[model samples]
Target: MCVAHASGAPPSASTKAKSRPCPESPTPSSLRPMTRPAPPRSGSWTARPPCAAVLRSSATTQCKNLGPCTSGCAQGAKSSTDITYWPVALRAGVELRTRCRVREITVNADGMADGVWYYDEDGEEHHQRAEVVVLACNGVGTPRILLNSTSPEFPDSLANSSGLVGKNLMFHPVGFVQGLFEDRLDSHMGPQGCCMLSNEFYETDPERDFVRGYMMQIVRGGVWPWSTAMLGARSGTIPWGPGHHEAFARRFDHTANIGILCEDLPEEHNTVTLDPELVDSDGIPAPKITYTLSENSRAMLEHGVARAKEAMLAAGAIEVTGGGPARQAGWHLLGTARMGDDPETSVVNSWGRSHDVKNLFIVDGSIFVTSGGVNPTSTIQALALYIADTMKKNLANLFD
Candidate 1:
């Protein structure tokens, strides 16, 4: 319950570092606090320095605007782990390695994780021996590593005695409700996805067709103009060819959007497996994600869309588009290496330590037993901080 941030991590470096007073203290809770999305950076052609540059403002390193920051934030405005924890770790003398792709974790003779085989950016192989192994490779990447770490002692892959390493994959299926309005809403002004949200339908209703519900988040305009125009026309949201300009003009400023982040139950069939046909440049097998929505999820989506359309209409939308079952929407991948009490049914235990390997700990969304309708980053970071504290309590005998 320590995750009380608007997002997963604290915003300002001073607050995170504790030199300055934190607005709130950690509290015990099961649910995470919800907040509006990032500030709108739409229609922006300007760039700012990342936090690192500010740290050394009088010195070298200036931020360059690579693009829209849709792929990644070159300006370092993003509170990514590299900028946050990595810098602190380096200052503490922790050796930080960049661009190294891990192949698999190597186990010792007694089936204990002790080392890793990874390839550097130059394709040079390196074996890193460690007292503990923490798998923080999101759901998909972690499972791929485990599945590929096939050894004679643990033939089914390391720490995969449960045969559930890559199973029970859960993704928060998403569907958008776009509303075209009469007046300009300036929907694209702020960072695209960061707007007010509603949790009115966040809980499950037994009376309904699904066991769980979803969150309806306000999605303002942050998409590129061309994407909005072309895809809108292609998807029939706008007119085509000559008339498309007129349609785009009408919808551009006068649009309201909402995204539904649905809770997905863990299904063993939704899996991540190494593709025999696909491999990375280092010749390591790449993971192939195979997921499909269950009937319950589909029913939930139908209900959600209906509710969204109703809301759009109430908000005076001239036209509403985008609904039904979400396709190609796998935003929050989770439950692949789920945590549980039993070693036979789960890959990791309650604290995200591997059931088959005592030294291996998973501190990511992969340990999520359930995918909440809300954003998981805050919860994920909270869990990590909790686990780190737990490990600290046992640092004297960590390898045991």
Candidate 2:
């Protein structure tokens, strides 16, 4: 159930260091006894500095002219079904288990998988002789699992004769704008958001600067000072206290925020390799991600921001701001064990079956041919359903 949006490693010590009070901590008198400012929001943007000068000031970050900041999407917007479907399937006799990392898939002389060997959480060796095995682990995990699963006949990894196991990782490079307004915007409290969506620039064929198109999203609430600082907000003469709160409230009341998500082209360099020196608590090597912001991504982000600002101003934003220099954003992984008709060029068939192992299947974001311009969870669920149906039709052939 880990969706496209749920990506990346835990924050490192360096990334977490920014949480120390930024000269902006509330005064001792203003501090509530047990309350603390919400832990600075985490994930991709959490690694940056918190000073307004470093990020951006709260004022300009919460402008009304800024289209929806966090309001366009429903606060409760979620894929609940995706979360529980597999477990529900398990209860209905689908046979699900975890912590059992595959070590090898025993293949018949005919190049078909007959069973798999793995280690349990206790490091106990065991085997699952199955007519079929499916790999639904996300993009990065799937490739590692495949490469780790070496066998005698195949010599290389299972279904990896083509040598295209781990390549082409992708995610959207996102940017946002926050602006200050003259009214209380109620930045928080509602279902995270539910407001505006602009696809005006979703698909641009122009070879101008960027290789991909970007989409815009808006939220009703204004941006927080810490978040602004991360986005390059500057410090100002604005005083803090009741005046600050009042100013923030007024701005929040009128504020709307806009965000742009542009496509990042898939490249072999953005790879996920195993860390030989550092293993996880389970003793499995941790996945080491090596990513860099490509020029194509940079161009898309810059152009997307310019287009977003223009739209915000047209939509009644009193002020418009831009964000950028696009970092190596994570999440939305795809094209690791890519799919193709030719077994020599890909890992799985169009139906996500291992070409060398008819009894094995891989159904997840890992098999994507191309990472499209949308949150991939919806499509992932649709694909799971499609693969499940394919399994049903081929169930008899699988065991034979």
Candidate 3:
């Protein structure tokens, strides 16, 4: 893995190390049961849930899986960015810097992206000039950097003439629906990221309380023994003390899970602002993310949870336990610097070019117009590639 750009929001670093073992293929054998398509609904009988390819790895394998791919594909089989584009870019001689944090985007009197100022590991500041700047520091980091780059001429923020740089931040609200089985499904035996998904209710129905919908995926919800035992106790399913051992023994291998990825709308109030009082070690202002689920999201969650329970029951699970919207995990942050035709309403144009700085481009989830219910990485990558192609054609005009 080689990291070229590092975010300034938190204690972060880049790496240029090689990964061990190949990521288990997306169709790992252990994941078949999880990957099998959910049946179509026959009303009362209920259909097999639709499958979502949101797995950190493609497939699920039992003990063969070192752990869930999210933890660190110990088996070396996760389709991560490091193993993908980095190799090609490196082979082509793109310098890969580790532990370099971009302090701010520098602009010239021409009001174009001139380059970036950054800090080395020793806290030494350095400036790197560039003909153009492409911001991909993620939803929070991108906006945080842009907001911090307030020059005398652009007091509001660079690339933020509409005052929308850090606004409309979004995260796909998630809820877990766990099912307890009488027999040991050995749920802990496979990849933890979800394998199967149901999209019966994916589309928006005017009759439903929400507008956009959500997705449900089958998850291992399995952690290593310690985490599993601890989470069991925390959820109050397993008792503490002498009974803890026995309770843990029974529950460890007998669980199945369904997880919800609710569609979150772009809301101005859900924003990423720079903290007035906090700063990172590099002396850059830290990010202050403010988010709240709307009524529509809550209602969508309610519907998803209900459907999750029904799915579990149909699968022959003895009991189901779960709830709405995961708060700790903000895996997908998007829409802060949206791409649209209207400069008055967006930060970047449709091709991700800044309306204020034509040479500056953004090609990340931050350019998303809407938050889809599934993992956004595939879409994020697709957009990045598209932007690269567009940049190839417009490179001559990029800095003009």
Compared with the true structure, all predictions reach lDDT values of: 0.71, 0.57, 0.73
Per-residue lDDT over 154-245 for candidate 1, one digit per residue giving the tens place of the 0 to 100 score: 88787888889989899888888787766665454433442445656667787898887887766664256776787676688777777877
Candidate with top TM-score is 3
Q: Tens digits of per-residue lDDT for model 2 on 1-400?
A: 2221212112222344323333321211111110222111111111111111112222122112222223332221222432335445666797656677765567777777778777887888788886677787788888877776666677767677787777777766777665544444544433222133344455666768665576565544434554433333233323354466544434544555556767666787877666778875556667777777788778777876776565555544566665874353466777788888998878888777888777888888878866765556556766777778888898777544
Where is model 2 poorest over a 10-residue stretch in terms of lDDT? 25-34
lDDT of candidate 3? 0.73
Of models 1 and 3, which has the larger lDDT?
3
- Write down the worst ten-residue block by lDDT for model 1: 27-36
On a 0 to 100 scale, what is the lDDT of residue 320 in model 1? Answer: 79
Candidate 1 off by > 4 Å: 5-78
